[model samples]
Target: MKKQIALLLSLLLAPLVSAAPAPEREKAQPSAHHVAIGLPDWARGSTIYEINVRQFSATGKFSAVTADLPRLKALGVDVLWLMPIHPIGEVNRKGPLGSYYAAQDYLGVNPEFGTEQDLRDLVNAAHAQGQRVILDWVPNHVSPDNPLTKTHPEFFWRDEQGNLTPPHGTDWTDVVQFDFRVPALLDYQADVLLHWVKNFGIDGFRCDVAWGLPTPFWNEVVRRVRAVKPDALFLAEAELPQQQVAAFNLSYGFDLHHAMNQIAQCKRSASALDEAYAKIHAHFPRGAALMVFTSSHDENSWAGTEFERMGAGYAPFAVLTFLLDGVPMIYNGQEAGLDRRLEFFQRDPIVWPAETHPTTRLYQVMTKLRREHPALHTGSPMRRLDTTDNATFYALERTAADGRRVVGLFNLTAKDAKADLFDPALAGEWRDAFTGETVKLDALVPLDLKAWRYRVLVK
Candidate 1:
């Protein structure tokens, strides 16, 4: 696995290393408000949790997840992004269960999952606990067996012989691509997006492969969906220059995630994270929120779990995302430290760790601090602090609008590190977030940290 990862990253970075240092990300200019998505009051500092109902529990059903709402609420999650709930097409399926993205019908519920009423019950239950639910949407493609293939053939592409083909350049044979040029097609999709809010009262959508489709289509969908559900939020699967203005409230921070991984694997210095964050903040539109994470469905299934890729750094990175800017996401079983490569197209249930486990406790503590600390909110003012070992140690200080302050530090290498940090602006007494002890930062303080360890001090 180590060799495979080394080869993969080498290929991905070969071109990047040869290229000149990228120009700093460009600041977005003003654009029309048609594609703008409004932020809700509850989401300003809230965290998101991703759930694949099929693998969430032993039953692999909606009831299993609904039953666990209180526990999730305790974990400090504000929104639940459920994987696609539509029925999977039987034709040309990849595995016995099939890929979740190959939707057979937009409006139909997968019996393998549960009934529409079951989903409605789940949503109602989540709302009762003060949490919102968003469905994962697949707008770029559909299973060949989908009704759109027959009802509106013009909605999809065709070859010289008039045969529908898979999305360009991939081995995804189970699904066919949709052409975004059709006005009627996009109009129909806008309705499909509203169906959840109009009937089941779903809070929003997490658009899959959002960058693969056209920007105008998203603009239209956003305009139509928010017409009635003004508080609904949108999370795009990919980040693009125009995606922030194209209608998403948040998008994946792929650049930052990759850089962090490289740092953990010893391919890059700890300061690489600072470079990645700076570039994304500069490029994304004003007020745009980036989603930072250590693991996800794709990362777990394809690359490896955080355990394999980050190893000892998993705990530190997990804590870092919670204390830093941008929103944090907890993929199912992440709190329990899932260690296997979950099968994407098959029946693979996650074996959660015992309740008293350290990972679970760490998530519980970090998430509570994430919810309670105003200093940790997205868009809060932050500055990088100088550290003794610039190559392996990272340190930062953040200040919230309410005057709350927090200082965070991490040792990103495989060796013990002593990073010295102090700032007159932060001179004062402080309380450790993980421990109840109080310490003074009035003078230059030396942090003796273990490899892949992180410390957070809140005031």
Candidate 2:
């Protein structure tokens, strides 16, 4: 009777176990629309260098930047992204100098930075050196004292008392938000963009707070601008996937940047990078370009310098920015190891060192490698190679259509770690980018990396 009871219980459980459904796999969420924009030929393999004009030199003038063109060319810079060049509003200003994003005029140059012709000459000089120039454009808002506030009151958003307001959910009191619902405002902004491209000969624009505007506005503006300059580049400060659909050629890699910071602080492991990349691949279109960087204007001023946040992991993370399948950027004072938080709304200029900094060589080598190897360019295919220590060691291989290949090995921890990379595809003779030594890999390659060490090999 006991044996009979046990058989009956097992029979009842077998059907329930078989009837249970399998767990569903996670799926990637792609953008609503397909990306229609193509990157300009000039930007495919290029690197961007941002210049905070207000803090770049003691004079903080366009002439100073113009004078540095030759040096920039020698440093392997292909694009110069100048921070806002318009006059800052005096009313409700943040500091003595005011915020650079608070524009007073769309078509006028800041007297503090010199005359309009000074900017024209700077653009001309950069173009002569085979470098492209992009302006940081503030379209979402303008200074409270801007002429538009009085002249075209319809272009602004107002509260119940009919008073202009700042951008929603922020403490940016110096500037008033724009009302994109007004058709004329769109037309005026479109014209403003065209004016720079036509008059100043600017290669493109870096749209500030781009996510605040509607996508259709950017689509229409890009359509109108491309009608004038077919290869004009547009970079969006936002990370929205839709921004790259038909407007921006590049968007910020905010997720990846944050992941790097987290990993550096030991709050997360190197595997966090893989998760970040997976999300990026899932959300963005196949060929969308992202700008990878360790530091930027906002990051340097508000949060902290790279050294403060990333500490000893700074150099290795910088190497990852260049090796990854995206266009890399170098902030103005990064090469000189600027470690202090620059005053955002003041006249704190960067002090120059008489001798060349070691970081300059690191950036030069990285940029040179990008120029020589199409495999390192944006839109190239990247494959992750499995390693013995996946949590701390990260390795990847990128290959271009022209059969060129490059590999990067990074140890994202602060302790000694060894990883035996296992990838049959890695079997080849490669040249070391830094030491100029030859490395031959078979089916397996053992890497003994010190804390925060990295290696770049080209084939």
Candidate 3:
């Protein structure tokens, strides 16, 4: 039996690296052609909250997250994106705890986090609160110590000496690349994805390095998964436009995120946001959802916290993430005003403040604005209104189909500035989103904005 298994592995790995024939449904789908997928109705006005389970609490357990669901629901989180829950591979691990991306088993829950029952309880609790849960799934690679390396050696890419290799052009020596050329590997991956949806009742997945895999694989996976759960949501951790075509409902808005950073540091003007939006509009298909944010796990651990990167302009940028024509995401601890970079490989829990932080209130206001106003929902029409000082002042109006309107004015610089907001669209009675004061805007209204201040006017 052992000799026969070895021979089977050799046969599977003999072919040159190439994508297997796409599933029958993908036969007519061109690689570059994009067709916008229908988004789940529940996500139309939803906000995503990313959870770093390892650093979310002192215990770093699923039970801890379960205990905090009420607070998250009150914070207006609609989707809870949990980081990988699989056991980490020990061989060639980066630090004492190892990277969460280094999966030792696809089917096993990490004991460090909790038992499988614990994860199920967390998902059930989230579902009871009307919040969707998506697991972070790494498809491009796996830890060298993964069980598949021994049970199905042909599933991995090997060097000339038949040694498993890391992904090309990266120092990620801990994880070995997967060979999607083998048809059976795709079947295995699909089964693993279905297992979670069927058993644990996870809503969908947030695929890591989604761009690394072939589009055909995603198309097939989406078809298979949705066959079971039609409303499953797929979020690609990439900005590639093609990924949104019939596979993923949302993709990361990295370009806009970078533009926000540049504007905050004065390396670019507020007009840079316009440029970024133009590119996004030109590239992505209409009705495609984009997830926009100022900070994430990668930004917090490798780059810096939003406080360190955006400095005084952090609040304004956070406001933009909500106001923009995309779904907004809040990284864990962001509401608590987490200032320091988190250790990626060690046990470093977020230090939550005893009292509610001011940032929490800011988020509450923004989230309330998002939930209550259809005009601010994803896929709503957003028009950039011209201002006198386009370099420092950014103004835009979002209008929903039902005639509701929300206008935002942002001072993207550190210096106080005044600009004339003159547009027929700006003529209306508006209430402040933060303060309840009412104001009227007429033709050519002159506005003085303090450094890094932002105003959200609802009509």
Query: What total of clashing residue pairs does each candidate reach?
Result: 0, 0, 0
Write model 2 residue lDDT over 313-428, tens digit each, in one string. 99998888888888899999898888899999988999878899888888989988887789988888988888989889989888999888999999999999987987887898
Give the higher-TM-score candidate: 1 or 2: 2
lDDT scores in order: 0.83, 0.88, 0.89
Most accurate candidate by lDDT: 3
Report the lDDT tens digits of candidate 1 across residue range 1-459: 999999999887443223222123333443433343435667767889999888998888998899999989988888899999999998899989999999999998999889998999999999998899999999989999998888888787665455777876668999987877678888899999888889999999999988777766787888899898988889988777576775788888888899889988999998998898777666666667778899989999999999899888888889888776788998988887788988988889988765646787788887788777888877788778887777888888888887898888889998887867766766788888888789777667778898888778888
Best by TM-score: 3
Question: Candidate 1: worst 10 consecutive residues by lDDT?
Answer: 16-25
- Note each model's CA RMSD in angstroms: 10.7, 15.7, 4.0
Models sorted by lDDT, best on top: 3, 2, 1
Better of 1 and 2 by lDDT: 2
Against the true structure, what is each candidate's TM-score? 0.91, 0.93, 0.94
Error of 2 at 454 (Å): 0.5
